[model samples]
Target: MSRGTIYNKDTFLTNVANQLGRKRQTSSVSLPKWKKSPQYDVFSELSEDALLDEFVKQCEAIHTEVIVTEMKEIQKVCEQVIHDLGGESLVYWEDPRFIKYGIDNVLEKKRETGMDIYEWSSTKGTFNIEKAERANIGLTFSDVTLAESGTVVLFSDKGKGRSVSLLPKTYMAIIPKSTLVPRMTQATDIIHERIKAGEKPPSCINFISGPSNSADIELRLVVGVHGPVRVTYVVIEDE
Candidate 1:
Protein backbone atom coordinates (compact mmCIF):
# COMPACT_ATOMS: atom_id res chain seq x y z
CA MET A 1 0.00 0.00 0.00
CA SER A 2 3.08 2.22 0.11
CA ARG A 3 3.28 4.90 -2.57
CA GLY A 4 5.25 4.02 -5.73
CA THR A 5 5.74 0.41 -4.61
CA ILE A 6 7.00 -1.82 -7.50
CA TYR A 7 5.32 -5.04 -6.22
CA ASN A 8 1.61 -5.97 -6.11
CA LYS A 9 1.09 -5.32 -2.42
CA ASP A 10 -2.67 -5.99 -2.48
CA THR A 11 -2.25 -9.43 -4.13
CA PHE A 12 0.56 -10.33 -1.73
CA LEU A 13 -1.63 -9.42 1.24
CA THR A 14 -4.46 -11.54 -0.11
CA ASN A 15 -2.15 -14.58 -0.58
CA VAL A 16 -0.77 -14.19 2.96
CA ALA A 17 -4.29 -13.98 4.34
CA ASN A 18 -5.14 -17.23 2.53
CA GLN A 19 -2.10 -18.92 4.02
CA LEU A 20 -2.98 -17.66 7.49
CA GLY A 21 -6.52 -18.96 7.13
CA ARG A 22 -5.18 -22.39 6.12
CA LYS A 23 -2.88 -22.42 9.10
CA ARG A 24 -5.71 -21.50 11.41
CA GLN A 25 -7.81 -24.29 10.01
CA THR A 26 -4.97 -26.70 10.52
CA SER A 27 -4.58 -25.57 14.13
CA SER A 28 -8.25 -26.27 14.78
CA VAL A 29 -8.41 -29.57 12.87
CA SER A 30 -8.42 -32.90 14.70
CA LEU A 31 -7.90 -36.50 13.60
CA PRO A 32 -8.13 -39.68 15.63
CA LYS A 33 -4.55 -40.84 15.26
CA TRP A 34 -4.92 -43.66 17.76
CA LYS A 35 -7.44 -45.31 15.49
CA LYS A 36 -6.03 -47.63 12.83
CA SER A 37 -4.85 -45.84 9.73
CA PRO A 38 -6.66 -47.28 6.74
CA GLN A 39 -3.74 -46.53 4.44
CA TYR A 40 -1.06 -48.05 6.69
CA ASP A 41 -2.29 -50.47 9.34
CA VAL A 42 -4.50 -53.45 8.53
CA PHE A 43 -5.11 -54.78 12.03
CA SER A 44 -8.63 -54.47 13.37
CA GLU A 45 -7.67 -54.67 17.05
CA LEU A 46 -4.43 -55.03 18.94
CA SER A 47 -4.16 -55.96 22.61
CA GLU A 48 -0.95 -56.68 24.53
CA ASP A 49 -1.14 -60.41 23.95
CA ALA A 50 -2.30 -59.91 20.37
CA LEU A 51 0.63 -57.62 19.69
CA LEU A 52 3.12 -60.17 21.00
CA ASP A 53 1.58 -62.94 18.95
CA GLU A 54 1.60 -60.82 15.80
CA PHE A 55 5.14 -59.74 16.45
CA VAL A 56 6.30 -63.32 16.79
CA LYS A 57 4.48 -64.29 13.61
CA GLN A 58 5.98 -61.47 11.60
CA CYS A 59 9.47 -62.16 12.94
CA GLU A 60 9.26 -65.79 11.98
CA ALA A 61 8.02 -64.87 8.50
CA ILE A 62 11.25 -62.94 7.98
CA HIS A 63 13.45 -65.76 9.26
CA THR A 64 13.90 -64.18 12.64
CA GLU A 65 13.56 -66.36 15.75
CA VAL A 66 11.73 -64.85 18.69
CA ILE A 67 12.38 -66.40 22.09
CA VAL A 68 10.17 -65.39 25.00
CA THR A 69 11.76 -66.06 28.38
CA GLU A 70 12.11 -64.75 31.91
CA MET A 71 14.92 -62.44 33.01
CA LYS A 72 16.77 -65.26 34.80
CA GLU A 73 16.74 -67.47 31.71
CA ILE A 74 18.09 -64.81 29.33
CA GLN A 75 21.73 -65.22 30.33
CA LYS A 76 21.50 -68.95 29.91
CA VAL A 77 19.92 -68.52 26.44
CA CYS A 78 22.67 -66.15 25.28
CA GLU A 79 25.35 -68.59 26.45
CA GLN A 80 23.55 -71.43 24.72
CA VAL A 81 23.29 -69.39 21.52
CA ILE A 82 27.02 -68.72 21.64
CA HIS A 83 27.70 -72.43 22.02
CA ASP A 84 25.30 -73.34 19.24
CA LEU A 85 26.74 -70.82 16.80
CA GLY A 86 30.27 -71.97 17.59
CA GLY A 87 30.99 -68.34 18.17
CA GLU A 88 34.71 -67.73 18.61
CA SER A 89 34.25 -64.01 19.08
CA LEU A 90 31.38 -61.96 20.47
CA VAL A 91 30.49 -58.28 20.67
CA TYR A 92 27.81 -56.22 22.41
CA TRP A 93 26.77 -52.67 23.00
CA GLU A 94 27.81 -51.15 26.32
CA ASP A 95 24.42 -49.55 26.97
CA PRO A 96 23.35 -49.51 30.60
CA ARG A 97 19.97 -51.00 29.71
CA PHE A 98 21.78 -54.20 28.80
CA ILE A 99 23.94 -53.86 31.89
CA LYS A 100 20.84 -53.79 34.10
CA TYR A 101 19.93 -57.16 32.58
CA GLY A 102 23.48 -58.51 33.18
CA ILE A 103 24.22 -58.77 29.44
CA ASP A 104 27.26 -56.50 29.74
CA ASN A 105 28.64 -58.57 32.59
CA VAL A 106 28.30 -61.73 30.53
CA LEU A 107 31.45 -60.82 28.68
CA GLU A 108 33.36 -59.77 31.80
CA LYS A 109 34.49 -63.32 32.41
CA LYS A 110 35.71 -63.57 28.81
CA ARG A 111 38.71 -65.81 29.46
CA GLU A 112 36.51 -68.65 30.70
CA THR A 113 34.31 -68.65 27.60
CA GLY A 114 37.47 -68.93 25.45
CA MET A 115 35.94 -66.33 23.12
CA ASP A 116 36.95 -62.73 22.56
CA ILE A 117 34.24 -60.37 23.80
CA TYR A 118 34.44 -56.84 22.51
CA GLU A 119 32.38 -53.78 23.37
CA TRP A 120 31.23 -51.28 20.79
CA SER A 121 33.72 -48.44 20.45
CA SER A 122 32.98 -44.77 20.00
CA THR A 123 36.11 -44.37 17.88
CA LYS A 124 35.69 -44.55 14.13
CA GLY A 125 37.40 -46.54 11.36
CA THR A 126 39.25 -49.87 11.27
CA PHE A 127 40.56 -49.72 14.82
CA ASN A 128 37.00 -49.85 16.16
CA ILE A 129 35.33 -52.17 13.66
CA GLU A 130 38.05 -54.83 13.35
CA LYS A 131 36.83 -56.73 16.38
CA ALA A 132 33.20 -56.33 15.38
CA GLU A 133 33.75 -57.83 11.93
CA ARG A 134 35.46 -60.88 13.41
CA ALA A 135 32.71 -61.53 15.93
CA ASN A 136 30.24 -64.29 15.23
CA ILE A 137 27.55 -62.96 17.57
CA GLY A 138 26.41 -59.44 18.35
CA LEU A 139 24.08 -58.32 21.13
CA THR A 140 22.15 -55.11 21.64
CA PHE A 141 19.30 -53.61 23.66
CA SER A 142 16.46 -52.28 21.59
CA ASP A 143 14.92 -48.85 22.05
CA VAL A 144 11.52 -49.94 20.82
CA THR A 145 9.94 -53.07 19.46
CA LEU A 146 7.15 -52.64 16.86
CA ALA A 147 4.75 -55.53 17.06
CA GLU A 148 3.06 -55.04 13.69
CA SER A 149 6.29 -55.50 11.75
CA GLY A 150 8.39 -57.30 14.34
CA THR A 151 10.86 -54.43 14.19
CA VAL A 152 13.56 -53.79 16.78
CA VAL A 153 14.86 -50.25 16.93
CA LEU A 154 18.38 -49.34 18.11
CA PHE A 155 19.83 -45.88 18.41
CA SER A 156 23.58 -45.71 17.97
CA ASP A 157 25.49 -43.58 20.46
CA LYS A 158 28.42 -43.79 22.91
CA GLY A 159 27.10 -46.83 24.73
CA LYS A 160 25.07 -48.37 21.90
CA GLY A 161 27.32 -48.13 18.84
CA ARG A 162 26.37 -49.30 15.35
CA SER A 163 29.04 -51.87 14.53
CA VAL A 164 28.15 -54.29 17.30
CA SER A 165 24.85 -55.16 15.58
CA LEU A 166 25.81 -54.51 11.96
CA LEU A 167 29.26 -56.06 11.38
CA PRO A 168 28.68 -59.38 13.09
CA LYS A 169 27.51 -62.56 11.37
CA THR A 170 24.57 -63.05 13.70
CA TYR A 171 22.67 -60.41 15.65
CA MET A 172 20.60 -60.81 18.82
CA ALA A 173 18.53 -58.04 20.37
CA ILE A 174 17.12 -58.11 23.88
CA ILE A 175 13.85 -56.23 24.17
CA PRO A 176 11.91 -55.51 27.35
CA LYS A 177 8.20 -56.29 27.25
CA SER A 178 7.42 -52.73 28.22
CA THR A 179 9.09 -51.38 25.08
CA LEU A 180 6.78 -53.28 22.78
CA VAL A 181 4.22 -51.23 20.83
CA PRO A 182 1.38 -52.15 18.56
CA ARG A 183 2.77 -50.51 15.44
CA MET A 184 5.41 -48.23 14.01
CA THR A 185 3.20 -45.20 14.54
CA GLN A 186 2.90 -45.92 18.27
CA ALA A 187 6.64 -46.44 18.55
CA THR A 188 7.31 -43.14 16.78
CA ASP A 189 4.86 -41.38 19.06
CA ILE A 190 6.75 -42.65 22.11
CA ILE A 191 10.04 -41.52 20.56
CA HIS A 192 8.59 -38.09 19.86
CA GLU A 193 7.35 -37.87 23.43
CA ARG A 194 10.85 -38.71 24.66
CA ILE A 195 12.30 -36.02 22.42
CA LYS A 196 9.83 -33.46 23.73
CA ALA A 197 10.85 -34.44 27.26
CA GLY A 198 14.49 -33.48 26.46
CA GLU A 199 15.71 -36.89 25.42
CA LYS A 200 18.02 -36.51 22.46
CA PRO A 201 18.09 -39.32 19.94
CA PRO A 202 21.39 -40.71 18.76
CA SER A 203 23.15 -40.20 15.43
CA CYS A 204 21.62 -43.35 13.99
CA ILE A 205 18.39 -45.26 14.60
CA ASN A 206 18.57 -48.74 13.14
CA PHE A 207 15.40 -50.78 12.68
CA ILE A 208 16.08 -54.47 12.34
CA SER A 209 13.12 -56.69 11.51
CA GLY A 210 14.92 -59.83 10.49
CA PRO A 211 18.03 -61.30 8.86
CA SER A 212 19.63 -59.50 5.97
CA ASN A 213 18.50 -61.06 2.72
CA SER A 214 18.00 -60.43 -0.98
CA ALA A 215 16.57 -62.26 -3.96
CA ASP A 216 17.47 -59.96 -6.82
CA ILE A 217 20.82 -61.51 -7.66
CA GLU A 218 20.15 -63.97 -10.52
CA LEU A 219 16.63 -64.25 -9.12
CA ARG A 220 18.03 -66.43 -6.35
CA LEU A 221 17.57 -65.65 -2.70
CA VAL A 222 20.61 -65.13 -0.53
CA VAL A 223 21.11 -64.36 3.16
CA GLY A 224 23.80 -62.25 4.84
CA VAL A 225 24.25 -60.22 1.68
CA HIS A 226 23.90 -56.88 3.38
CA GLY A 227 24.22 -57.69 7.09
CA PRO A 228 23.67 -60.50 9.58
CA VAL A 229 22.62 -63.88 8.22
CA ARG A 230 20.54 -64.67 11.26
CA VAL A 231 18.64 -62.38 13.63
CA THR A 232 17.28 -63.31 17.04
CA TYR A 233 14.94 -61.52 19.41
CA VAL A 234 15.01 -62.42 23.09
CA VAL A 235 12.01 -60.89 24.83
CA ILE A 236 12.15 -60.60 28.59
CA GLU A 237 8.70 -60.46 30.21
CA ASP A 238 9.76 -59.47 33.71
CA GLU A 239 11.95 -56.61 32.59
Candidate 2:
Protein backbone atom coordinates (compact mmCIF):
# COMPACT_ATOMS: atom_id res chain seq x y z
CA MET A 1 0.00 0.00 0.00
CA SER A 2 1.22 3.45 -0.90
CA ARG A 3 1.09 5.88 2.01
CA GLY A 4 0.55 9.61 1.59
CA THR A 5 3.60 11.62 2.66
CA ILE A 6 3.80 15.32 3.50
CA TYR A 7 6.78 17.36 4.59
CA ASN A 8 6.60 20.50 6.68
CA LYS A 9 10.04 21.04 8.19
CA ASP A 10 9.12 24.10 10.29
CA THR A 11 5.98 22.39 11.73
CA PHE A 12 7.94 19.20 12.49
CA LEU A 13 10.71 21.15 14.22
CA THR A 14 8.15 23.07 16.32
CA ASN A 15 6.51 19.79 17.42
CA VAL A 16 9.88 18.32 18.37
CA ALA A 17 10.70 21.46 20.36
CA ASN A 18 7.40 21.22 22.24
CA GLN A 19 8.03 17.53 23.04
CA LEU A 20 11.51 18.29 24.35
CA GLY A 21 10.16 21.10 26.52
CA ARG A 22 7.60 18.73 28.08
CA LYS A 23 10.31 16.13 28.68
CA ARG A 24 12.54 18.65 30.42
CA GLN A 25 9.67 19.82 32.67
CA THR A 26 8.85 16.23 33.66
CA SER A 27 12.49 15.38 34.35
CA SER A 28 12.84 18.34 36.71
CA VAL A 29 9.51 17.69 38.50
CA SER A 30 9.79 16.89 42.22
CA LEU A 31 7.67 14.30 43.97
CA PRO A 32 5.27 15.27 46.74
CA LYS A 33 6.87 15.41 50.17
CA TRP A 34 5.81 12.79 52.71
CA LYS A 35 4.05 14.08 55.83
CA LYS A 36 6.23 12.15 58.24
CA SER A 37 8.97 9.57 58.29
CA PRO A 38 7.95 6.01 59.12
CA GLN A 39 8.90 5.14 62.67
CA TYR A 40 9.89 1.73 64.01
CA ASP A 41 11.27 0.77 67.40
CA VAL A 42 13.81 -1.90 66.52
CA PHE A 43 15.24 -2.13 70.02
CA SER A 44 12.19 -2.54 72.20
CA GLU A 45 12.78 -3.98 75.63
CA LEU A 46 10.83 -7.26 75.78
CA SER A 47 11.64 -10.39 77.70
CA GLU A 48 11.45 -13.79 76.05
CA ASP A 49 8.46 -14.81 78.18
CA ALA A 50 6.75 -11.50 77.53
CA LEU A 51 7.26 -11.86 73.84
CA LEU A 52 5.95 -15.41 73.86
CA ASP A 53 2.89 -14.39 75.84
CA GLU A 54 2.20 -11.46 73.55
CA PHE A 55 2.66 -13.68 70.48
CA VAL A 56 0.32 -16.25 71.93
CA LYS A 57 -2.28 -13.60 72.66
CA GLN A 58 -2.03 -12.26 69.15
CA CYS A 59 -2.49 -15.75 67.72
CA GLU A 60 -5.44 -16.54 69.96
CA ALA A 61 -7.11 -13.23 69.08
CA ILE A 62 -6.98 -14.24 65.44
CA HIS A 63 -8.42 -17.70 66.16
CA THR A 64 -5.08 -19.38 65.56
CA GLU A 65 -3.75 -22.31 67.60
CA VAL A 66 -0.24 -22.14 69.03
CA ILE A 67 1.56 -25.43 69.64
CA VAL A 68 4.59 -24.78 71.87
CA THR A 69 6.98 -27.67 72.29
CA GLU A 70 10.55 -28.85 72.73
CA MET A 71 12.63 -30.95 70.34
CA LYS A 72 11.70 -34.11 72.19
CA GLU A 73 8.03 -33.16 72.48
CA ILE A 74 7.38 -32.08 68.88
CA GLN A 75 5.54 -35.30 68.01
CA LYS A 76 3.37 -35.31 71.09
CA VAL A 77 2.56 -31.62 70.86
CA CYS A 78 1.82 -31.96 67.15
CA GLU A 79 -0.60 -34.80 67.83
CA GLN A 80 -2.29 -32.94 70.65
CA VAL A 81 -2.70 -29.71 68.69
CA ILE A 82 -4.11 -31.68 65.74
CA HIS A 83 -6.57 -33.53 67.93
CA ASP A 84 -7.64 -30.37 69.70
CA LEU A 85 -8.18 -28.66 66.39
CA GLY A 86 -10.35 -31.61 65.29
CA GLY A 87 -7.74 -32.87 62.86
CA GLU A 88 -6.13 -36.29 62.66
CA SER A 89 -2.37 -36.61 63.11
CA LEU A 90 -0.40 -39.40 61.51
CA VAL A 91 3.30 -40.15 61.33
CA TYR A 92 4.58 -40.20 57.77
CA TRP A 93 8.03 -41.68 58.14
CA GLU A 94 8.55 -41.45 54.38
CA ASP A 95 8.08 -37.67 54.52
CA PRO A 96 11.48 -37.22 56.16
CA ARG A 97 13.14 -38.06 52.84
CA PHE A 98 11.65 -34.95 51.22
CA ILE A 99 10.15 -32.57 53.80
CA LYS A 100 11.95 -31.06 56.78
CA TYR A 101 11.18 -32.79 60.07
CA GLY A 102 9.38 -29.68 61.44
CA ILE A 103 7.28 -29.22 58.28
CA ASP A 104 6.29 -32.88 58.42
CA ASN A 105 4.50 -32.09 61.66
CA VAL A 106 2.53 -29.31 59.97
CA LEU A 107 1.71 -31.64 57.08
CA GLU A 108 0.52 -34.25 59.52
CA LYS A 109 -1.76 -31.63 61.03
CA LYS A 110 -3.17 -30.86 57.60
CA ARG A 111 -3.65 -34.55 56.92
CA GLU A 112 -5.64 -34.88 60.13
CA THR A 113 -7.76 -31.97 58.94
CA GLY A 114 -8.57 -33.91 55.73
CA MET A 115 -6.36 -31.70 53.57
CA ASP A 116 -4.29 -33.33 50.81
CA ILE A 117 -0.57 -33.58 51.53
CA TYR A 118 1.96 -33.81 48.71
CA GLU A 119 5.73 -33.57 48.69
CA TRP A 120 6.87 -30.46 46.82
CA SER A 121 9.16 -32.11 44.32
CA SER A 122 10.77 -30.10 41.53
CA THR A 123 9.21 -32.43 38.98
CA LYS A 124 5.77 -31.66 40.39
CA GLY A 125 4.98 -28.66 38.17
CA THR A 126 3.89 -25.40 39.79
CA PHE A 127 1.63 -25.62 42.82
CA ASN A 128 -2.14 -25.25 42.42
CA ILE A 129 -3.04 -21.91 43.99
CA GLU A 130 -6.76 -22.69 43.86
CA LYS A 131 -6.31 -25.81 45.96
CA ALA A 132 -4.15 -23.92 48.42
CA GLU A 133 -6.85 -21.26 48.84
CA ARG A 134 -9.28 -23.86 50.09
CA ALA A 135 -6.81 -25.10 52.64
CA ASN A 136 -7.76 -24.16 56.21
CA ILE A 137 -4.18 -23.83 57.37
CA GLY A 138 -0.52 -24.11 56.31
CA LEU A 139 2.37 -25.18 58.54
CA THR A 140 6.08 -24.78 57.99
CA PHE A 141 9.42 -24.45 59.76
CA SER A 142 11.07 -21.00 59.81
CA ASP A 143 14.63 -19.84 60.29
CA VAL A 144 13.77 -17.90 63.45
CA THR A 145 15.01 -14.34 63.63
CA LEU A 146 16.64 -13.23 66.87
CA ALA A 147 15.23 -9.73 66.43
CA GLU A 148 12.82 -8.15 68.90
CA SER A 149 10.16 -7.86 66.23
CA GLY A 150 9.19 -11.47 66.91
CA THR A 151 9.46 -12.08 63.20
CA VAL A 152 9.82 -15.51 61.62
CA VAL A 153 11.94 -15.55 58.48
CA LEU A 154 11.13 -18.25 55.95
CA PHE A 155 12.71 -18.89 52.59
CA SER A 156 10.75 -20.24 49.63
CA ASP A 157 13.36 -22.82 48.68
CA LYS A 158 12.93 -26.60 48.88
CA GLY A 159 9.35 -27.73 49.61
CA LYS A 160 8.38 -24.45 51.25
CA GLY A 161 6.72 -21.95 48.92
CA ARG A 162 5.75 -18.37 49.83
CA SER A 163 2.21 -19.12 48.72
CA VAL A 164 1.82 -21.80 51.36
CA SER A 165 2.01 -19.10 54.01
CA LEU A 166 -0.05 -16.45 52.22
CA LEU A 167 -2.79 -18.52 50.55
CA PRO A 168 -4.00 -20.48 53.53
CA LYS A 169 -6.53 -19.00 55.96
CA THR A 170 -4.22 -19.79 58.86
CA TYR A 171 -0.45 -20.19 59.08
CA MET A 172 1.30 -22.19 61.78
CA ALA A 173 5.04 -21.43 61.89
CA ILE A 174 7.51 -23.52 63.85
CA ILE A 175 10.47 -21.60 65.29
CA PRO A 176 13.16 -22.54 67.82
CA LYS A 177 13.13 -20.27 70.86
CA SER A 178 16.89 -20.47 71.07
CA THR A 179 17.08 -18.47 67.84
CA LEU A 180 15.15 -15.52 69.25
CA VAL A 181 16.92 -12.14 69.03
CA PRO A 182 16.46 -8.98 71.04
CA ARG A 183 16.27 -6.70 67.98
CA MET A 184 15.95 -6.47 64.21
CA THR A 185 19.54 -5.23 63.87
CA GLN A 186 20.74 -8.58 65.13
CA ALA A 187 18.53 -10.32 62.59
CA THR A 188 20.00 -8.25 59.76
CA ASP A 189 23.51 -9.03 60.99
CA ILE A 190 22.75 -12.74 60.99
CA ILE A 191 21.39 -12.53 57.44
CA HIS A 192 24.37 -10.44 56.36
CA GLU A 193 26.75 -13.00 57.83
CA ARG A 194 25.00 -15.77 55.97
CA ILE A 195 25.19 -13.81 52.73
CA LYS A 196 28.89 -13.01 53.34
CA ALA A 197 29.56 -16.72 53.74
CA GLY A 198 28.54 -17.16 50.06
CA GLU A 199 25.14 -18.59 50.91
CA LYS A 200 22.33 -17.80 48.51
CA PRO A 201 19.30 -16.21 50.12
CA PRO A 202 16.09 -18.16 49.96
CA SER A 203 13.75 -17.38 47.07
CA CYS A 204 11.56 -15.65 49.66
CA ILE A 205 12.34 -14.17 53.07
CA ASN A 206 9.12 -13.41 54.98
CA PHE A 207 9.13 -11.59 58.30
CA ILE A 208 5.77 -12.32 59.85
CA SER A 209 4.98 -10.35 63.01
CA GLY A 210 1.26 -10.95 63.28
CA PRO A 211 -1.78 -12.07 61.36
CA SER A 212 -2.71 -10.34 58.11
CA ASN A 213 -4.60 -7.20 59.01
CA SER A 214 -5.65 -3.90 57.52
CA ALA A 215 -7.40 -0.74 58.60
CA ASP A 216 -7.94 0.57 55.09
CA ILE A 217 -11.73 0.51 55.06
CA GLU A 218 -12.98 3.67 56.75
CA LEU A 219 -10.19 3.15 59.30
CA ARG A 220 -12.01 0.14 60.70
CA LEU A 221 -9.51 -2.63 61.40
CA VAL A 222 -9.90 -5.91 59.54
CA VAL A 223 -7.83 -9.07 59.73
CA GLY A 224 -6.75 -11.42 56.97
CA VAL A 225 -7.11 -8.99 54.12
CA HIS A 226 -4.44 -10.01 51.63
CA GLY A 227 -2.95 -13.00 53.46
CA PRO A 228 -3.60 -15.52 56.18
CA VAL A 229 -6.07 -14.12 58.72
CA ARG A 230 -4.40 -16.15 61.47
CA VAL A 231 -0.68 -16.69 62.15
CA THR A 232 0.49 -18.97 64.94
CA TYR A 233 4.10 -19.38 65.98
CA VAL A 234 5.07 -22.63 67.66
CA VAL A 235 8.15 -21.67 69.68
CA ILE A 236 10.16 -24.79 70.36
CA GLU A 237 12.26 -24.64 73.51
CA ASP A 238 14.89 -26.95 75.00
CA GLU A 239 13.65 -29.48 77.49
CA lDDT scores, all candidates in order: 0.78, 0.60
Please report how far candidate 2 places residue 164 from its true position, in Å. Answer: 0.8
The runs of at least 3 residues in candidate 2 whose Cα sits more than 4 Å from the true structure, single-residue gaps closed, are 1-65, 83-115, 128-130
Residue-by-residue lDDT tens digits, candidate 1, 1-239: 23464688767766887888842232345646666456346454777677788889999788998888888887787666666666688888767776688765566655366778776766654655888888898888888888888899888877566888888999988888888887777767777888979997677888888888899979887888979998888888863
lDDT agreement of model 1 with the native: 0.78
Counted clashes in each candidate structure: 0, 5
Residue pairs with backbone overlap in model 2: 88-112, 146-180, 146-181, 147-183, 148-183
Model 1 spans with C-alpha error above 4 angstroms: 1-44, 123-126
Q: In candidate 1, where is summed lDDT lowest over 10 consecutive residues?
A: 22-31
Give candidate 1's error at residue 193 in angstroms. Answer: 1.6
lDDT top scorer: 1
As for candidate 1, its clashing pairs are: none
* Alpha-carbon lDDT of model 2: 0.60
